[model samples]
Target: MSLYQLVYYSRNAIAGDASVFEAEVDAILAASRRNNEAAGITGALLFNAGVFAQVLEGPLAAVEATFERIQQDERHGDVSLLALEPIAQRSFSNWAMGFVGHSAENAQRFAAIGLTRGFDPARLGGHKMHAILRDLTLEEEAAAA
Candidate 1:
């Protein structure tokens, strides 16, 4: 199968109080992990400053199908596809659906990386967004280890 990677961002539309939001995010991650693993897809999702950025890598058909489901989900709004192209390898190969959420330390790290104003995925573009998610997820993996 030809490997392909897709990068996208969406405005958070999960309406609720903090607890509700957290629960919804947890549910999303759980479902994504299960479905992605079954479909042989790997990816990382980053949620920060009311935005969701994700990178998905796998067979072209699987990635596209997964993305189609995401686009139809109500939790996401204004879902914009940033990049979708053939890739030689998977960047998040170890993860079915790695996730990184907002935190004080993460805010500081974003600022240090020249996102002091805020995390704007559209302006940052696909490559930078992918890099940020990849780096942050790796950091999380290291901490878990």
Candidate 2:
């Protein structure tokens, strides 16, 4: 299967209590996992506050199809793609669907990789987390297995 990486950004507007938002987030993630697995695709989902940064890799057709399905997800709207590139490596060869919840520590780890200026708790939106996710696919590929 040809490997592909896709990136997207969208504004977060889930205005309510944290628990309400969390429940919605859980449902969205579950649907994503189901869809990807059915298509033989695997990757990771990184959610930081309201920013959704994901890297899905698998058969070219499946990658495209999965994104198509993602666009219709009610929890997310205004999706904007930042990048989509072909790579010569397989990052999550063994992961059917890996996930990460972004936090201060993860932000710091991303900064060390040169993807951003470093973890600034106040500037979470400014950090290039998607770049970090793309790099992690390879950086932690061994561990991912």
Candidate 3:
């Protein structure tokens, strides 16, 4: 399977508040999983408060098509892709879609969050900043469900 690395930033409005944010997050994750499965894709999603960085693996065409749909999604109307390109590795092989949290320590490792302004396609400092949440297996998602 071909893999694509996609990264984007979202406004703070994406996470409006506690309860609403939880509900929205749940719904979005479910939708992502369904879409990925429908398109024969697998990937992990990382959220650093507002920004979203993801890696999708599947047929190249399927991955690109799904990303096109994502660009038009109203739920994340502010979604702005910083990068979309072929990748040599599949960071997530087992998950249809995974929304994993980056630890606070990891978040602080590469760059201070708020201080980092502007999204540069060449600056992949976020992923470099955290230890990815790939450790959560399908079993973990099921248990959470």
Residues 1-21, model 1: lDDT tens digits? 899999999989988899999
Instruction: Give the winner by lDDT.
Output: 1
* Model 1 per-residue lDDT at 103: 80
lDDT per residue (tens digit) for residues 83-145 in model 3: 566778765667888775545554563244332335442354435422233444343566678
TM-score of predicted model 1?
A: 0.94
Ordered by TM-score, highest first, the candidates read 1, 2, 3
Instruction: For model 3, state the Cα shift of residue 145 in Å.
Output: 16
TM-score of every candidate: 0.94, 0.69, 0.65
lDDT against the true structure, each candidate: 0.89, 0.64, 0.62
Q: Which residue pairs come into collision in candidate 1?
A: none
Clashing pairs in 3: none
- Minimum summed lDDT over a 10-residue window in model 2 is located at 118-127
- Our model 2 lands, by Cα RMSD against the true structure, at 5.0
Q: Is candidate 1 or candidate 3 better by TM-score?
A: 1
Best by TM-score: 1
